[model samples]
Target: MTQGLSTPRLAALASAPPRPAPPPGEAVERCELCAEPVRDGHRHLLDLEEGEPLCACGACAVLFDGQAAGGRHYRLVPDRRRELAGFHLDGPLWAGLGVPVDLAFFSVSGTGEVTARYPSPAGALHAAVHAASWRRLAEVNPVLAELRPDVEALVVHRARGAAEHWILPIDDCFRLTALLREHWTGFTGGEAVWRHIDAFFTELKRPGRPPRR
Candidate 1:
């Protein structure tokens, strides 16, 4: 199915995959749900009511993978980053969306509202997104139809002569935002920040295909 990109999608970024194993002096972060010992590569859970991701151990993440028994509580954020090579978008369409940044994320909220956000030195910044534009894109992309409500997102990037798109877990979106926050400098993000962002998309387009949807 064809995918389209224009502006940010609604959903908060996630608890980043922890950095590489810590040194002996640093403390490790344990699972907030079960207090189980967790490694840096552990997964995350989306707290629907809170609209944030909680670090979770493997067992707890799996146990709550499905919908909560009482009501919508935690939704396990799946880890998949698919390159949408067939995405559709053009100058006029993108201009209509009106996102201020080159890279942004889109997700659906618990209330089924579509939202958009972009990375910034101050962290991710939210902006107004016309729902009609989003609906039009979804109408064209069957893969985007696969985005799990509140847990997955459509990330669109346009900069430095590159056009990249992905269907990624919400957590990865936050990780991207954090990377920008830590590296951004000067008005146009300088050379260092662009370098990192370039390398990031380079890897995203690397040989390894994301797991089948």
Candidate 2:
């Protein structure tokens, strides 16, 4: 006769960890709020209460398009991208921002706090910037005044004495941070990571499609 499996072993098996979800490209993404299937490039809503981005269906996203929409709980993140061709940022002003990396994104919170976030091998690291500096930058670049707080970001990239500036959606900044976090290797980030970085900027230079309703 065969012996029965022990109760402890059965209990342990019942508590086994769940399998990991499929990769981003392979997974079918659903809206976090309504569970509607969203396409790969779906719009996102920022959960102001939770301080995190939420995947949202087209209907849910439109409900929170305005700043005061959704009762202050969620804010629709815009999908605009504008290259600041004439923006000025000298070394001194850049240094005053206090970002340690060549690439960083700046955003103002609802509470008027200014922050600069740069990517590292571990993840995104945050740094504080003086309000005066931000104000000075905004004075020079009037377009910066148009950025919607908590939804848009000023992304800066300085490499080999070349400077590039763009007003991008907050999610775009998050995507860049995620890319660096995933591809970075060793102290210099290796050639493969740089190639990916180059590709990212190249794509950004192209035109963006209109937002989906």
Best by lDDT: 2
Instruction: Summarize candidate 1's per-residue lDDT along 1-213 as a digit string, tens digits.
Output: 112212221222222343565686454767888787776667888777766678888888778767553158788888777889889867766776667677878887656677777765444577656778877777777777788788888888887677888888887776676667667786677798889788777777677632110
Candidate 1 Cα deviation (angstroms), residue 123: 5.0
lDDT for each residue of candidate 2 in 91-179, tens digit (9 for 90 to 100):
88888787767888898888888878875654457877889988888888788888888888999989645577988888777666656
TM-score of each: 0.79, 0.81
lDDT of 2 at 125: 70
**Colliding pairs, model 2:** none
Compute the lDDT for candidate 2. Answer: 0.74
**Cα-based lDDT for every prediction:** 0.70, 0.74
Off by over 4 Å in 2: 1-27, 210-213
